[model samples]
Structures are given as C-alpha cells and as structure tokens.
Target: MAKYKAPLRDMRFVLNEVFEADKLWAAMPATQEVTPDLVDAILEEGAKVTENELFPLNRTGDEEGCQFSDGDVTTPAGFKDAYNLMAESGWMGLGGNPEMGGQGMPKMLTVLFEEMLYSANASFALYPALNSGAALCLDNHADEAMKEQLLPAMYEGRWLGTMCLTEPHSGTDLGLIRTKAEPNADGSYKVSGTKIFITGGEHDLCDNIIHLVLAKLPDAPAGSRGISLFMVPKFLINEDGSLGERNPAFCGSIEHKMGIKGSATCVMNFDGAQGWMIGEPNKGLACMFTMMNYERLSIGIQGLGLGEVAYQSAMDFAQERIQSRAPGGAKYPEKAADNILVHPDVRRMALNVRAFNEAGRAFASYVAMQLDTSKYHEDEATRKKAAALVALLTPVAKSYLTDRGLDCTITAQQIYGGQGYIREWGAEQYVRDARIAQIYEGTNGIQALDLMGRKVVSNNGEYLKLFAQDIQDFIESNSDNAAVQPYLEKLGASLETLMQVTGNVITRAKDNPAEVGAASQNYLDLFGLVTYAYLWARMVAVAAPKAEADTSGFYSAKVKVANYFFARILPEAAALAAQVNAGADTLMDLEEELFYGE
Candidate 1:
C-alpha cells in the first residue's frame, strides 16, 4: 500500500475556503479564542501523530489482532505506546470541555482531526473515539459530582470509556434489553447482564474502563421506558480519585470479527457490577442516545477516513503499475506499456473516490459547524435551527458516507486487479475495515428509517423544508453566475424531486406504516445526493473564479471534481425518487414465510 499522508490541502480547502470555518468560529463566543494559527497548528500536529504513530500500526495491528485471556484483553504490539502518546499529547481531549482539563476545540476543527485519525488506523482510533463519545455523554447527562470525579481523568486519558447497548438478543431493539439494575442502599445500583459487541470494553491501554451501560430498574416501567443508564467502571474509584478493588464488570470473551480486529469487541458479563445511575431512572435510552449521536458521526468519519486511505493507495498503484497501452496510443511510448492511469476507466474510478471523499469531508465539516453553532451560538433561535440541521443530517452523514466509503474501497481494490484481493497488497484490509462502518453505529438501513420516521415524518417535514429553503436561497443568490449555473439548475431540480418524494412518503406512511420502511433507504439516498449537490454547487462557486487565474491548477481540480459529481453522481437522485415512489406494496405484498423459497 502507498504511504498514508493526511490530505492537509483538501482539509484546509474545506475548512478555510468552502466552509469559512474561521469566520464561523469567530462568531461563537465558545470558539472565539480559537485563531486560524491555532487551528493550523492543531491540524498539523494531528497529522503528525496519526501519520507517525497510528499509520504504521494499520497493517501490523490487523495482522496481530488482539489477545484475550481470562478477563483481560490486550491490544496489538506498539498499540499501548501509541495510545499513550496520543493521550499524553492531548489529542484525545482536543474537543473536551476546557474547564475539565480539555482544550475544548470546536467540532469543526476536531472533525478534520478525526478524519485523519480514522484514515491512519481505524482499529487504533476506536480506543480514543469511544472515550470522546463517552465523555460527551457524561458531560451532558451525568450529575455534577459524577462529572467532577470522572471527566478530568477521562479527558487526561488515565481512563477510557465504552458504550454497552447491544445484547445477545437485543440488537436494534433496545426495548428488549434484559440487563437488570438493582438499587442499593448507598444510592448506587448493581448492573448485571451480558452485553455483547461492546467495543473497547476491556483494554490494557487505560487503567480503568468506564462503561455507559443500559439496564432496567426493579420497579421500572416495561419496554424502552423502563431502561436506565449506568456508569460502570472496570475498577471502582475512591473519594481521592484513586483506584480501588476491581469491579464486577468482566470481559467474558471477545468476538472474532471480520474487520477492526485490533479493537476488542467484547461480550461483557456484568455480575452485579456496582454502578451509578446517569440521568433519571427509565430514561437510560435517552442518555445512551446522547452518546450514540456523537458516535454515529464519528463512525461516519471512519468511512470517510478509510475511503481516503484506499483512494491514495489506488492512485499510487495506478501511476506506477504498467499495463495495457492507452486508448490514444501509449502516453509513455518509451516504455513497453503505459501505466493504468492512462485509461479512462481507471480515471472514472479514481475520480469517483476523490469526488465522494472531498464532498464527504465538506459535508462532515458542515455538520460539525452546525454542531458548534448549536452548542455555542448564544442566540436561542440560531441554536434551535442549528440543532435541527444536525438532527436532519446526522443520519445522512453516517449512512451515505459509509455507503460511499464501501463503494470507494471496492473501486480502489478493483484498480489493483487480482493483486487487490491478496492480503500482501494491504488493499483488502481497507475493504474489510471499511465494511463495518456501514453495519455499526446503527446500520445504514436503520439510519434511513430514523431519517424517514423520526426526523422527517414525525415533524411533518419541517426540518426538511428548512433545509430545502437553504438550498433554494443559495440557488437564487448565485443564479447569475454562469460558471455555476448548470450545477445550480441541477441542484434545484433535485431539491424539487426530494420535496415531492418526501410528501409522497408522508402521505403513504399515514395509511400504511410499511411505506416508511419500504421507501426509507431510497429516500435517504435521494436526500444524501441532493445534499451533496448543494455543497458541490457551493464548492464550485468558490473554486471557479480562482481556477481562472491560478497557475497551480489547485482550484481547477476542485471544479473538475465538482463537475463530475453534478454530472454523474447527482443523477442518482432521480432513480432513488422513482424507487421511493414505488411504495410498500412491492415489498410488503410478499408472504413472510415465502422469503425462504421452498
């Protein structure tokens, strides 16, 4: 595989140019202290850590995987040292609250850093990624005493965090979780149950592992409402912030997964583990979601990151591997055969990966910007709007980015021909690593359902309308610019199609609930396509004028990718709309038992 280099230029382009991140940061009081120089320094250092410490482990970690014995889990060689370096260097707390010993950087900035982390080593990245998400949950829902006791150490990397939601039987349906939390006289509860698929549940990298587990109280209501959140640590903490005896939470076993093998996916056996309740009783699902929302976006970045590494590897291979002659005769006539880069098909694959990676970066940053705004805007109305956009786009960011990440990885593998399938090339590892992003953090299918049912249908498409209005407003303002006219027109048409399809889904879903499930996936794809079109249109508007006068061709490349997206990718929205309009009859008409075919 090619050497992993952080795409600093494109990251800068998206943050400083496409999104004007500095200006947005300046407007928010919470981010006002963040200067452009500080942001650049952070990005540069983040790149260094990921490239130097994490990138080298990508292959080795996958090869060695993790070791498990008894109740102990051990990471691959060099992983412990690399993790310590990451934590000691303060990368883990880049987005943590400042008052709690964190840098409290804006999400807009950290999202880029996160992309770099995932691109370098996804398995290793999961360690701190879970910590960040866990910290966010505690910061929001945990009591003041809990935060004071845990937040500082967690931010400083003395401890790590994990989220335990899934069980052997309860996967997507949290209402069926059988974990039991019995209240004790000391105000803490004993959390007892077996939680499966818990990432970083028991690792040697940190002294203590804090688990945000979901369970039910003795007299709690039934179903999801009965579920409550708990903070179960691997080792109990004393009043002086010292570690006490080991807690009952034990890693019973680990799963042999297809990808991300270095990260311990444990089956945690909580044998009456002493735990503290977070938020109110029977509201554990809500608290868990507070972290899950953060994690969903992080997992999406996993997709974007893996796609980037795969694309770089593919581009490297295409430029060096000599194959058949070019269509218009050999570009390198002196050589026996020209490199595969000379072929249009190779270019199409490369360009497709590039197009999605760049757009995904911009889209993720845009969402991060909204996140910063929602948290620190100071104005109630602005915060509400930003929060709504975050809700509407979170599913898109998680699902579309992973779907495209998988597509890009497969395309990258295709560029290597037969060599791609071999483990020696490292290309296959990327494919395996990226596949889980779509499955976890709520499967891409679940994301579509959430997008259609909760975020859209439940609100009567109010957020969707707000989003469409933003696109329409952008089109009207830039309609006169000839360079971006085509993109604007295409985006406008796609927006209209999205609106029409959304109305159809809402109308059909009212009578038959199955319609939401049937149309959801396609509806999400359409929403994602049109959303990308809007961002690409904005990107082209910024790049066109610069391309006209620049000799570097930097801006020209941006314009070319934007053009490719509009012409080739944006058209997917039309087909998705048609599929969504096909309604539930085609899907629900078939008998359930017949699905197996006699």
Candidate 2:
C-alpha cells in the first residue's frame, strides 16, 4: 500500500513564510476574513478528511473503476458516499462564489486542498475538479437569474457539472464541431449533438449533471466564429427550484482505459435537449476558455499530487526493504543487509522527486496568488499586471509540472526495482494515473506550443518580459544576502539564457513557422527550470537564516534540497536552451512522404 501524509508543514512554508499569504489575504477585501488560524484549521481538516475518506478508496476505486449499463453510470464503490460527505461538508464549493452559498476561499488556499484531494485519490478528484471548473465558467458568463437557479445547487453538489466541447471528429479543433442549437419558443434552445470524452457527464453520485456544451446557431458564421455555448441539464428545473422532467441529454456509454477509471468519461448524446445560451451567440470558445484555463491548472495539480504520493510511498519502501550495504560499509552491521536508504543512488532518486514536488507546490501557489490579485486587487494597474503574469505562467504550470510529474512517478517506481512493476505495491498505479494529466487538458506539447507561439512570439515577448523582470527584481533585491546570493546568481544566469532563447525563437519563427513548434517544448523546459530556480532562491532566503538553530530540521532540509536543485537540476536549462537554438531545419528538412509507412 502507498503511504501519504499531507506535507502541511511545507504547504505552510510556501503560503505563510514564502508568500506571506496571511498579509496578502488581509490586504484584499474579499479574502480579509481568511486568517492564519483559519487557514491552518482548513488545512488540518482537509488533510484528515482526504486521507481518511478518500485515500482508503484510491486502490479500490482503480480496481473497480466505473460501471455502465443502459443509460446510467455508477462510480466505483465508496465514491458516492465519499462524494456526498464532501458536498455536505461544503467542500465542493470551497472556492466558489460566496453569494452562491460557497465558502468562497481563495484559490491559493483551495489549491492546497486540491493537492491533498489529488494525492489521496486522482480518479476521485476528477469528479469535483470538473464541477469546480464548470461552476467557474457559469459564474463568469451566466446571467443573474441563471446564476441564482444553478450556481447554488452546483456549488452545494446537489447537481454536478461537466464541460462538453469535443465531438467524435473534433478534439482540439473546436472550429470543426457540428453540434447545432436551434431556437425554442421560450428563451431556451433545442440542442442536438454528440459529445465524447466528457468527464462526469453521467454519474449516480449526484441528482443531476449540468453540461456546458459548445454548439452552433442556425444563422451562425463559418468555423469557430459560429460556435456558441449552452447549458444543458440532465433534469430540467421547475419554477419552484425542483426537478421537473428529464432532459433529452443521455449518456450513450463510458470509456474504459489506462487510468482514472473511477471517473466516468462519457459519450453523451443530446437529442433536442432544452438548453440556454451563455455569453454571446458566437463567442463560446472564449467563454469555454474560462473553464479550460482553470482545468489546465487543476490538472497540473493532479500531477504534483501524484508525484508527492509516489515519492512518499517509495521512501516508505526504501526505509524497510533491505538490498545491499552502503558503498562505504553497512550502516546496520547486525542486519543481513542494509536498507536501500543507505545507497547513494537511492538517496539521489528520492531527492530528485522531492525537489520537484516541493518546488511544484510553491509554483502552483504562486500562480494562484496571482489569480487572487487579478480578481480582488483594488488597483487597476496591479490587477492587469497580475493577470498578465497569470497568462504567462498558466501554460508552464500545466506542461512542466505534469511533464516532471510523470518523470517523478516513474523514477519513484524505479526506486522499487522489480516490485514497482507489480500491481500489488501501488507505485504502478500512480504512473498510470499521472500519464493522463500530461495528455488531457491539452497535451503537454500543445501547452508548450501555446507558451512559445501564442504567449511569447505573438505578443512580441511582452509577457516574457513581465516574468523576466520579476525574476530580475528578486535577484537585485537579494544581491546583498550571501546565503542566497549564490543561488540567486545562478538563477539570474538561467533567466538570461531563457530570455535569449525566447528572442531567438521569436526571430526564427518569422522566417519559418515550423521553428515555433520545433523550439517550443525545449524553450518551455528551459523556462520552467529558470522559474523553479527563482522559487528555490526565494525559499532558501527564508530558510538559510534560521537553519542553524532549527530543531525540527524542516528549514535545514529546505536549504539542502534547494542546494541540490541548484547544483544538479538548474544546469538542464543550458542544454534545453541549446536545443531551442538548434532551429527548424533539423526537423522540417525531412521528406514527409518517405516516413509515411512504419
């Protein structure tokens, strides 16, 4: 069995010590009620609930998966009870709107809770994850009356939600969708379409499911411009806020595959379903992006959560599994063989996973903080700046965290040697679950391309400049501190390398469009390393001064991990930068027809 205890200490360090989230919460009117005591209490309860209610179900959920028959879908055993427990406790709406009966927590705080959810059970986590993102989309675009009718119930978890965008023919290309929405006598539309790969599309855990669907109007324009969003429910609501009649939307079937089987990924068919339009008639893609962006970050958290659990579970194995003596000598001379913890290679693998997991947590929180500032800050300029930063980092967060997340899980699995391949130990399951995060919510490749082509090149490097300036400012501000000066110096160099690579890619893309795609993944990797380096510097600055006298060794361990990251990990930035500079010809020069048949 895998072991997982929420790293509340490190979460606090990132939120309170590193980011000074309490001060941030106090400064913002919306989050003013969130104090240190309240934050700690939430973390404590979140840890307990997730570990107790959800962790016990992780393996069982994976084994049982989801069951489908007729038009109904049933999640694995214990899922419905655990989900209701969460909803009744108001956890489903932890970050929802306060006016809609939600707890209205900040994203920074909720993100930590989300990590615990994913760590405990990634498959179970997808249900609420989709709900939260759907609620966010409806909240942003829906009118007051619709919000009143739907948001509260969705938040309360009486009715869960899902986003329906892909059809049988279209996945990433929303412009190619053939779904149609015809006007009805009342204000609603009659939606007719089939959407595939819909998470939480149909489930027995909740009373109804609200689908935010993408479709086209009768007189709409061509391609994506003709697309619109609709809110279709499994059961229509009556005037008195009760279930009236069953809508025509039905689940044709559910998918069976690699991982997250506990989540019901459905093939839905809407047969003239009664629906209402969201936003304008032809502006649905933009509206849907509101939810997509949210899910991208949430999916990234899925990876981080899986990585953390994998590391802890692997370390638990390392502590007791005797393999060989240390290179020097056996630490446990009386034992038949020393535990694997004595081996330097074992320590190396553990530290690699730990370093990324810790940095990834802090990085997620930083992005969430920017989101809070963008939404709640009083100053317009500050809000704009934060929003720009959020846009710049969202792709990095989604791609890099997940990419490293899969890598970390695999490495942790390797730590188990042959046992990791066996299903009974649970490390293999983490690998399977982590794999989907990279592919879904936009593949990591797509994310890297978005970061390079849209964010960096198309904007003329304006977004990159904002991020670079922040790192530069941090380095300059801490130049005088010797403890952090070394890491800061290296971070500064990495930032400069990233900037040079970005500029080169931008210039090269002007001549060859393929350059953008060729350079994208490498550029994103370089950028991710630089970003983690800056975060590690910030963490060490806070830890170094207090390390000597610390009894808990938390601060000391932080300093050591930061050292490992800077010494061993940050150097990858240079190699990636070189790959980015290698240009498009290396890939584009190949003859297309020659490689046709494998």
Candidate 3:
C-alpha cells in the first residue's frame, strides 16, 4: 500500500516563508481574512484529510475502477464515502464564490490543497475539481436566478459539476465544435450534442451533476466566435430548488481509458436538454476561459501530484529494498545487504525528481498568486496587470510543469527498477496516471502553441516582456546569495537565449507557416527549464542559511540538489535552443504518407 504524505513543509516554505503569502493576502482586502494561523491550520487539516481518506483508496480505486451501467457511473470502492466527506467538509468549495455558499479561499492556498487532492487520488480529485470549475462558470456568467438556484447546492456538495467542452470530432479545435443550442419560449435553450471525455460527467456522487456545456446558437456565426456556454444538469430542479425530473442529459457511454480509473469520463448525449444560456450568445467562449484557466492549472498540479507521489514511494522502496553491494563497499555489512540509496545513480534519480517537484510547486504557487491579485486586488491596474500575468503564465503552468512532471514520474519509477513496471508496487500506476496529464486539458502541444501564438506573438511580445522583466528583477535582487548565485547566472543566460530564439522563430514563421508549430513544444520546454531554475534558486536561498547547522543535514541537501540541478538540469536549456533552430523542416520535412501505414 502507498503511504501518501503531503509535502506540507515544502508547501509552507514556498508560500509563507519564501513568497510571504500572508503579506500578499493582506494586500487585498478580499484575502485579508487569511492569516498565518489560518493557513497553518488549513494545511494541517488538508494533509490529514488527504492521507487518511483518499490515499487508502488510490490503488484500490485504480484496480476496481468505475462501473458504467445504462447511463449511470459508479465509482470504485470508498469513492462514494470520499465524495461525501469532501462535500460535508467544504473542501470542494474553497475557490468557489462566497456569495454562493463557498468558502472563497484565496487561490494560492486552494492550489496547495489541489496538489494534495491530486497526490491523494488524481482520478478521484477530478470529481470535485470539475464541480468547482462548473460552479465558477455559473457564478461568473450565469444570471442571478441561476446563481441562486444552482450554486449553493453545488458549492455545498449536494450537487456536482462538469465542463462539457469536448466533442467526438472537436477536442482542442473548439472552433469546429458542432454542438447546437436552440432557443425556447421560457428563455431556456435546448442543447443537443455529444460531448466526449467529460470528466465527472455522469457520476452518482451527488443528487445532481451540473454541466457547463458549450454549444452554438441557431443564429450564431461560424467558428469559435459563434459558440455559447449553457448550464445543463443531469437531473433538473423543481420550482422550490429541489431535485425534479431527470434531465435529457444522458451518458451515451464511458471511455475505457489508459488510467485515472476512478474518474468517470463520460460521453454525454444531450438530447434537447433544457439548458439556460450563460453569458450572451456567441460569447460563451469568453465564459469558458475562466473555467479553462482554472482547470489548466488544476491539470498541471495533477502532473506535479503524480510526480511527488511517485518520488515518495520510490524513495521509500529504495531505502528498504536491499540489493547489490554498494559501489564504495557496505554501510550495512552485518545485514548481508546494502540499501539502494547507497548507490549514487539511484540517489541521483531520486534527487532529480525532488528538484523538479519542488520547483514545480513554487511555480504553480506563483501563478496562483497572480490569479489571486487578478481577482481580488483593490486597484484596477493591479488587477489587470495580474490578469495579464495569469494569461502569460497559464500555458507554462499547464504544459511545462506537466511535461516535467511526467519526466519526474518516469525517473522516479526507474528508481524502482523492475518493481516499478509491475502493478502491485503502485509506481507503474503513477506513471500511467501521469501520462494522461500531458494529453488532456488541451494537450501540452496545444498549450505550447497557445503560449507562442497568443501570449508571445499576438501582442508582439509585450506580455512576454513583462513576464521576463519580473524574472529578471527577481534574479537581480537575489544575485548576492552565494549558495544560489551560480544557479541564478545559469537561469539568466537561459532567459536571454530564450528571447533570441523566440524572435528567430517568430521571424521565420512570417515566411514559413509551419515554423511556429514545430518550434512550439521545444520553446515551451526551454522556457520551463529556466523558470524552474529561478524558483530552485529561490528555494536554495531560503533554505541554506536556516539549514546549515541542523543535525539532519536537511538544508545542505537543498544546496546539493540545487547544485545538481544547475549542473545537470539547466544545461538542457541550450539543447532545447538548438532544437528550436532546427525549425519547421525537422517537423514537416517528411511527406505526410510517411507517418501513416497503408
């Protein structure tokens, strides 16, 4: 059995000690209520809930999986109870609107809990996370009547929620979506579409499952500009706000996926379901953006969560499993075996995973801070600046963190050797579970294109400049820290290389259309490597002085890991830069038929 432990210490160090989150919380009156003690209490409780309730069910959940009968989805053993606990404890509503009965916690804090949720059970976490996202859409774009009728119950966990954006034909290409929304007499819209890969779409976890479905109105224009969002429910509600007739939304079937077995990914058939229009017609994409940003970050953490869990399990196994003689001779000769950690190569892999996981944790928290400011800052300028930062960093958070997360999980699995490949160790499951993170939530490839096209080039690198300047400022301020100075210099050089590469790619794309797509993924990875280096530098700065005298050697370990990352990890930035220059030819060189077999 996997003994799941939330890295609350690392989380607290990143948020409270390094980021000074309490001060940021104080900066915005909306978040002024969050105090240090409150944050501590929250982390403690969250760690407990995750370990005790969710972790025990992870392997079992994956083994038993979810059951789909007719149109209903049944979660594997212990999930129903877990859902009830989440609802009753108000964990699902942390980032929800307070006006709608949610706890309305700051996003910075919410993301920490989100990480733990994924770490505990990625498959199970999708249920409440999707529910929260659906509630966010309704709270932001739905009418007052809709908010009054829907949000409280959803927030309270009596009802769950889902985002119905994907179709069988249109996944990332939302512009090609064919779902239809027909107007009705009572101001409601009749939505009819087949939405596939709908997470938490038809779960029996709650009395009702509210779906924020994206469809096109009868008079809507072509492409993405024409799409609109609708509030569709699995079970309709009566006039008194109680459960009424079952809605037209039915699960056509469920996907038999590679992993995330506890999450019921439904293929929903909405046959003229009575769905209330959200926002204005053809403006649904704007509404969905709010939820998409939320989910993108959530998905990134799924990668982080899996990576961290894999590292922990692998580390534990490495410590206990006695195998082969140590390279330097035995530390435990009397026991007739040597612990795996004595091997430098094994330790190197474990440390590498730790380095990536820690950096990812910081980057995610930093992104969450921008979201917090965007939503709650008192000044409009402050809010807008933060909003742009959120837009700029979203792709990085979604794609890069996840890509590294997959890398980290695989490396950690390698630490387990053959045991990692087998199912019983639970390490293989982590890698399987982590793999989906790269593909879904707008596949990492699409995420990179988004970063390049919208964030960098669309505004002619204005947002990119702002982001780069902020990183530069951090580097300049922390230049004097002897422990982190080397890492910072490497990070600074990578950023400069990134700037040059982006300009070349954009200029090349003007003459060659395929250049952008080819350069996209590598550019994203290149940027991510640098971003993580900066964060790791910060972590080293914060930990080194405090940890020097400790008997546990905890602080020195950080410096060593930071040194390792600077020596090994950050050097890859240059390689990514080289790959980016290879350009569209590397990707489009071969004929299309070469990729397919007759």
TM-scores vs. true structure, each candidate: 0.99, 0.99, 0.97
Error of 1 at 196 (Å): 0.3
The prediction achieving the highest lDDT against the true structure is 2
Question: For residue 594, what is the lDDT in candidate 3?
Answer: 94
CA lDDT of each prediction against the hidden true structure: 0.92, 0.94, 0.88
Q: Tens digits of per-residue lDDT for model 2 on 1-598?
A: 6999999999999999999998888898999999889999999999999999999999999999999999999899999999999999989999999998888999999999999999999999998999999999999999988899999998999999999999999988888999999999998999999999999899999998999999999999999999999999999999789998999999999998799889899999999999999999999999999999999999999999999999999999998899878899888999999999888888889999999999999999999999999999888999999999999899999999999999999999999999999999999999999999998888899999999988999999998898888888888888899999889889988988988888898888898899999998988889888989999999999999999999999999999999999998899988999999999887988899977997
Q: Can you tell me which runs of candidate 1 are displaced by over 4 Å? A: none
RMSD of 2: 0.8
Question: In angstroms, how far off is 295's CA in candidate 2?
Answer: 0.4
Residues 1-598, model 1: lDDT tens digits: 6468999998998899988988988888889999999989998999999999999988999999999998899999999999899889988789998988889999999999999999999999998899999999999999999999999999999999999999999999999999999989999999999999999999899899999999999898989989999999999999999999999999999999899999999999999999999999889888888889999999999999999999999888888899989998979999989999999998899999999999899989989988999999989999999999999999999999999999999999999999899998889999999999999879999999999999999899999988888899999999789999988889899999999999999998899999999989999988988888999888899999899898988999999999898888888888899999999998988888999958
Residue 9, model 2, lDDT = 94
Error of 3 at 83 (Å): 1.1
Off by over 4 Å in 3: none
Of candidates 3 and 1, the better by TM-score: 1
Off by over 4 Å in 2: none
Instruction: Rank all candidate structures by their lDDT, best first, as comma-separated numbers.
Output: 2, 1, 3
